[model samples]
Target chain A: MLSIVAALCGLMLVATKAFTAEQIASNHHSYALKTIEHLLQQEVPATFSLTDLPYGECDNYIVNQISAAGYVGEIQYLTVWRAQQDTLSMRVVRHSETPGIGDFIDHQRSPWITQFDFESAQAFTTLDGVSGATVTSNSVRRAAIGALKTKDIYCG
Target chain B: MGEPKTKQTRTFSDGVLKRNPAWIQLLGLCPLLAVSTTVVNALGLALASTFVVVGSNVCISLLRKFILQNARLAVFVLVIASFTTIATLLLEAYAFALYMKIALFVQIIVTNCMILGRAESFASRQSVGKTFLDALGTAVGFSIALIGLGGIREILSQGTLLAGAELLFGSAAKGWTITLTDGGLWPLAGFAPGAFIVAGLLFALVKSLGRASTEQPPMQLKGES
Candidate 1:
């Protein structure tokens, strides 16, 4: 009986893994492309093709995706470069900040995240809360600065 | 305990309505109430619970002859845990977002009295076919209760139906969201306390209807006389 139970249980799990492996892999691979498309304000790409510069790319500009330590965990963001352009743009991809309060840093949750769309991270270094999410705001500020530093590390 | 012969139809209907694991029976209210904040969440959890219950019940019924009387409960738990693991893995591999949304709750399904109760009481004594029917009925009842509570909370809290539908149903379900009010009010309805109030209201509504339908007078107390 124990053997029967073990065999059945093992078979079921093996079958389940076999079935869902493809979709799980697909969802992971598409994460980068999805973030890129959202930042660029473009249609879903027919194919995913990314060009990494010494710095992050905007168009002909540089781009970088970096993670910064927040209150609890790392906050990931995408930075697009600006050459002739005056302002740089970045979007939060994931974070582990408190919900309802800190989540304001998310552009989807609130437009407060749009404050970081700049050529440099200087102005946003001491931004006040558009709402009341100061901790999350600071994390986003740090992340933007982190994105800028990547250029120094690579190109400069 | 000796097996009490039950009519096949009654056994099935009892699990579905008269003894709904979530609503009428209120067997597994913790995860049921917690995750029923949205249709997508409710649907995902319901699917997971059903898969575990049905799978466990079938296994218990088939193994009744082989399992010792004293060890039945222990084995039943082991069986329930195995199926729960299978359900969790399936969710992670195929429905990644849904898996993350109901992350903590999936394991809690093992402690759900509904699945264990059915395994020990009915599945251990009944035919595998009959146990399957009972599990199906119970699962359907659970799904209905979850969807009802989820609908109420979502409509009241966010003024939307099927918000984040893609979490369960995939990308095509992205457009399933429906706007209710200009913006939904009573956001608290999606929180823990809100679930308690809504559950109380549901019980009240059911009790009132039960009262309205019962026409017989109270039975006399012969023992006192």
Candidate 2:
């Protein structure tokens, strides 16, 4: 009985996955384009591929994935670069930092992540991290630096 | 022994009010308290949850007779997980922003006590129609608790209602934000701690309201809490 049910459930999952994969991928593509547009502060690019980065022709706008040595674990983020190679924005897209404190790196939870926006790479150096969440802030800072310096970027 | 049939309305209201899983039974409070800080997030999670509950209940009811007793829980988990995956994929395809905000929390619905409890306690034995109504009732009850909490928190913390109305209602609703106050918002209410504070206040409010006709007055509630 368990095996039968498991087989049926697995079939249902496979069907659903096939049905939605394309639409979900397209949705993600549009979102990445929107983020790239925001960083460039210009008309949405004619085309951009996340796999092939330094996306915009101007190269002023880039979104790169970077993982820095965070306090609890490596912090993974997408750093949006713009304007004379400054960080237009930094979002902690994924992280395993402590909740209630370190997880504040997520903009949905706290605007502390906004502090990195619009800061040039050189300017980012002198910035103070979030008081209580120093490790997370520093981790995000390191991630952003790496993202900005990397030639390969992850727009997503 | 086979239990006597329950009245349809009574069964429905039991899930909605008298035995509300969130307000009274207090099951599935984590998502109720966590993802409900904003109206759109609350609505997104609630809809996804309702989808899973209704779908799993249907599947569980249909398959109840053939289940091996010992493996019943495993079957239930598989059915629930399948529906949850479907819901998550749909949300990703249609409402990407809202999905991202809630992707982690929504996946946890597979483990939500309210949905699983319904599957184990009722859907496993009940007829299809009754289970369907119960699932809807349960979803409605959960939605009420979540939206109520979300409304209060968003209003106090953001100084605006439906602040990011587009996420759920689409581009047409992007202009739907209604600024309630020029007074500054208390940012704390927008975070985790504020959910606890607001949920506590809501619990007290609901309890006090329940007491009004039987044992109390409105003025007393104001002073008591």
Going through the candidates in order, the fraction of native interface contacts each one reproduces equals 0.41, 0.80
Off by over 4 Å in 2: A55-77, A80-89, A92-103, A117-149, A152-156, B1-6, B183-187, B211-225
Q: lDDT tens digits, residues B152-220, model 1?
A: 999988999999988877899899999988666898898879989987898668656655676444222
lDDT of 2 at B181: 80
Q: What is the C-alpha lDDT of each candidate?
A: 0.74, 0.77
DockQ of each: 0.24, 0.55
TM-score of 2: 0.79
Candidate 1: residue B113 Cα off by (Å): 2.4
- Taking the tens digit of each residue's C-alpha lDDT, what string does model 1 give over A15-121? 87778778766764466567666665665446445444333443456667777776657777777656655355777766656554565666665676676565355
RMSD of each: 7.2, 5.8
Shift of residue B80 alpha carbon in model 1, Å: 2.7
Candidate 2 contains a number of clashing pairs equal to 0
